[model samples]
Target chain A: AQSVTQLDSQVPVFEEAPVELRCNYSSSVSVYLFWYVQYPNQGLQLLLKYLSGSTLVKGINGFEAEFNKSQTSFHLRKPSVHISDTAEYFCAVSVSGTYKYIFGTGTRLKVLA
Target chain B: GAGVSQSPRYKVAKRGQDVALRCDPISGHVSLFWYQQALGQGPEFLTYFQNEAQLDKSGLPSDRFFAERPEGSVSTLKIQRTQQEDSAVYLCASSFLAGAGELFFGEGSRLTVL
Candidate 1:
């Protein structure tokens, strides 16, 4: 079985400040990592994903994540965030050989103006 | 092109009532999935379909919950004897057949059981 863990339940940051949301996973086989963002009343959108290439994966909305295989971590990071960036973020992991994705509880990012 | 779409954005049903939610996947998508998201929680996998065949339904909460993708283009999730715990947002997603593509999601259908 595969599982994801997001260490932070909530993170508050000032506008234009850097932010990081930590995520870790436990899987018996190779995995693919992904970050997704959800705005109010909207469905989740892909933020970024780490499949098999570079460890530093860049995504839409100025977001990125680093895949650390040894640590089993794929933490999402943004250099500078805006108030509009306030949303719920989720970290997910899927086995390399399968399509089943297991998602973390979620981290609420509050970018205060 | 139109993205994954779900109908009946919101549904209110009685405890014993039966309800059905619909999903229309992107044209040509060969993989479809169903998930349940409780308030403030991430979406949890409910079932998965490859083309018109349901390949995985291990995440379904109960036998009362059923899903079908008869023609491989549109899918439906049906719930019978709804319970309060079943009140949640039902999300539908789709991807390419190769199984290495990203999953596109729908806005989801919020079901409220009374």
Candidate 2:
């Protein structure tokens, strides 16, 4: 079984400021990592993913995440945030060989104007 | 349409009543999944289907929860004798394949048991 841990339950940042949301995972086998954003009353949208290759994965909306295998971390970052960036973010992991996904508790990002 | 769709966006059920939620995956998608999201928490896997076969259902909380993908495109999740604990958002997602691919999600069906 695989599990994900998001250290922060909520984060507040001023507009145009940089922010980071931390995530870590535990799995016995290799895994794929992903970040998803969900707006109010809406479905989740993919932010980025780390399947293989480069450790730094760029996503939409000026967001990026770094996959650190040794540390078992995939932290999401944005150099500058806007008020519209406020949303709930989730970090998930799927086993390398399976379709089942395990998601973190989630981090609520509030980008204040 | 373009994205996954779920029916009965909001449902209110009395305790001990049964309820069913529907999901329509993207055309040609070979894999589908069901998850439960409690307030302030991330989605938790419930079951998965590959084509018409149910590949995994280990995450289902109890035998009272049942899911089926009859024709491989539309899936249904049925809960029998619903309890207050069953009140949550039921999310449906689909992917082209199983691994290393992105999954598209639906708005979800919110079920409230009172």
User: TM-score of B chain for each model?
Assistant: 0.96, 0.99
Best candidate, DockQ: 2
Supply the global lDDT for candidate 1: 0.92
Best of the candidates, lDDT: 2
Off by over 4 Å in 1: none
Stretches of candidate 2 exceeding 4 Å from the true structure: none
- The lDDT per prediction is 0.92, 0.95
Worst 10 residues of 2 chain B by lDDT: B94-103
Clashing residue pairs, candidate 1? none
Candidate 1 scores an fnat of 0.46
Q: lDDT by residue for model 1 over B39-103, one digit each (tens)?
A: 98889999999999999999999999999999988999999999999999999999984345788
lDDT of 1 by residue, A1-113 (tens): 88999989999999999999999999878988889998988888888888897999999999989999899999999999999999999998888868798889999999998
Estimate the overall C-alpha local distance difference test score of candidate 2: 0.95
